[model samples]
Target: MSLIHALQSALGENAVLTQQADRARYEQDWRGLVNNPSLAVILPKTTAQVAEAVKLCAAHGARIVPQGGNTGLVAGAVPILGPDQVILSFSRLRAVRDVDLLSDTITVEAGLTLATVQQEAVKANRFFPVSLAAEGTAEIGGVISTNAGGLQVLSYGNMRAQVLGLEVVLADGTIWHGLSGLRKDNTGYDLKQLFIGSEGTLGLVTAATLRLYPPVATRASALVGIENIEQGLGIFTSIRHAAGNALTLCEFCTQPALSLGAAHTPNGRLPFIAPAYLLLEISALEGARDPREMLETVLMEALEKGRVLDAAIAQSERERLDFLALREAISEGELREGGAVKHDIAVSLSRLPALVRAVEDLVARTYPSLRPNIFGHVGDGNLHVNIRPPAGQTMADIANHKAAITRDVESLAISMQGSFSAEHGIGQLRLLGMAAHKSQTDLALMRAVKQALDPEGRLNPGKTIPES
Candidate 1:
């Protein structure tokens, strides 16, 4: 029988989607840049099914593109340049297998959305704080694979830290049952960490055991306008000093980002028309003192120190949602306005101001007329540097300039001992950047690991690790 026929026979008709329309949906990514569709879209319902499909593909020398919700910023979920590959999507395997409230951990299938996991935690009177705008759709497998760092990274760290264990299927169809909730394990290599941010190139994540936290009893959010990025950093330091671990998130938004939000999104409210902006949030556990009052006192101190020009604190839950709406709306607003060159990078907390100023100055001198939107989780030092050229410039123009801009910005980030791809994983988008930034020895070690895990190069090849 043919490879397609073998896959269909093993997975049944309902699990295999072979039509052009269905296959088309799996071709491109969120950015709509890469377009390499496949001959079939396999929806595996279990870890055995995933391993079986992968084994069959290996036997036939076929390539497999493992995917989750397809909400990736880079084109990592989509195929690179061939139509002969198979797009193995994990959407059908949505299942929460186990939840140990006493242990403060949950084991869920790869297809479960991050939002669903969060809801499950809430139902159990616990919390899962790794949140993003796409949490409603982005799946747990993709998040773990990408090691996504969201708004709460300042307090909770990234997905890597949140995951205690995982169930991964190797390239040769063997299942590695490392899904233990034990916090302390010095048995051997600690295999779970290898696949957490491997981007599915090393192994296919079937399920994961994630750490949980106590649910927040009270929360406070505010949008504070600062004179510049320096003041924003100062406020962050001051608030962290006052509230300690109670501080949940601290995001920075530039004037351009606020302007874009005000112009595009509905009900977009900019509290203060300052050069830079800061969005601060804090949450406290039950029986703890109200975090709102503490946050207010910190902001008041910032104002006294002349670090904050103006501020708007959320009075109700609805008001807090409105304030967050402005920050989340910036990306869509900027996209609607025109084309933009985007970068997800990180620098040291102490060096953010200098990095931002240097990059801004470099862009101004180089592009002359480009207005960049600089904003992200300032508490964690990750910033999304988006460049929007003046009106009438085609997207091609922006694409043409991506290399030069990326070089300058990435160099600056590297100089400060920061990551080139902070939240966004090193998909095909940053393969070249990886080469530029990473050392020869580092790249070789990564390749050796990839080869050791997926010897056939069938599991999401042409991603994460550069070509050997």
Candidate 2:
């Protein structure tokens, strides 16, 4: 029997998709960037099935692109090698394998959506802090593979910090079961980490043991209007100094971006107009002081010091979700208006203002037809600065300038000792950035690791790492 027949035999025919309609759902990326067809899309329901599929693909000398939820911004989860590769989708492999409350960890199959994982943790009266707008559909495996960071990184850190252990299937179909929930295991090399952010290039992550935290007993959220990025950063500093880890989130948004987000608000109005806005949140275990009170005090001080122009503290849970809705809607709003030349760049907290200023200057000096929609996890120094085209002009109008715009913005981030790709992993999109921005030593070491783990390049070819 051939590979398709073998896959169908190993995993029921329903699990093996060969028709264009069956494979179409997994073909296009979240951004609709690539829609390359594949030879087959394998839906594995268990680790054994995943291993079997990998083994069969290896035997046939066919490449496999591991995907989860198909919700990646960088087109990392989609295939690019024409009709030769097969997609090993973990959608049916979702299962709550184990939940260790004592260890404060949850082991879940690769296909469990991030939101589902969060809900599972909540069912156990625990908290899983890796959150992003895509949490509703983005899977745990994809998040682990991308090492995604979101609003909460200000306090909890990225996906890397939350992963305690991982169960990975090697490129050659060997199952490396390293799902240990122990927080401290000073064993050999911490091999599980090698596959965490490898973008499915090194190995296929079948399941993961993720860290959990005590449920938030008290929480608070606020949206404050500020005069400029400096004022917004100042407010972030004060909140961090005062609340410490209680400050679970601190997001910055430009006025233009806020306008876009506000359009999605229930009232369809800007919360309170200003040059910039800061949407922040605080959470803590039950304590004498309410988190809302703590947030109020910090904002009061900023207001008294002229750092804050106007502010709205979430008075209830509904209001808090409303506040978050605005921040979350910013990206959708931008897309509705017409997508911009987007860049995910990061710098030190102190240099964020300078980076924003430099980008503004670059746009002003050249490409006068574009406006900036800058916003992100400012507390962690990551910003999604998208330069939008002037009203009525779509991305096509600015097509000629997109390359130069991305180059200059990325180069500015590098000049500030920042990264060109911050939270979003180097999927096929940023491979050019990797070749352009990554140092020689960095590329060589990355290639060495890739060679050791995936010698034949049979796993997710033409992604993450550029050709040497």
The top-ranked prediction according to lDDT is 2
Error of 1 at 112 (Å): 0.5
Candidate 2: segments with Cα more than 4 A from true spot: 265-268
Q: Residue-wise lDDT of candidate 1 within 1-468, one digit each (tens)?
A: 888899999999878888988788888887777887687899988999999998898888888888999888888888888536888999988899899988999999999999999999999999999998888889999999999988899998999999999999888989999899999989989999999988999899989999999999989999898988899988899889888888989999998887787776577767669888998898999898788898889888778878789988999998888777788778777667665787889988889998899889988899877777899999989999888877777567677787888888888899889988999998889998898889999999998998788877888878988875
Candidate 2 at residue 269, lDDT? 66
TM-score of each: 0.97, 0.98
Q: Where does model 1 exceed 4 Å of error?
A: 262-264
User: On residues 1-468, what C-alpha lDDT tens digit does candidate 2 reach at each position?
Assistant: 799999999999999899998889898987666789888999989999999999999888889999998878788989995537999998887899999989899999999999999999999999999888888988899999999998898889999999988999998889999898888999789998899889999999999999999999978999899988899888888888888888999999988887888896676566678888999998988663688878889889878887789999888898888888888888878777888888999999999989989988898989777898899988889999899999998888888998889899999999999999999988888998999999999999999999999999999988999988
Worst 10 residues of 1 by lDDT: 391-400
C-alpha positional error of residue 297 in candidate 2 after TM-score superposition, expressed in Å: 1.7
Residue 271 lDDT in model 2?
60
Which pairs, if any, clash in model 2? none
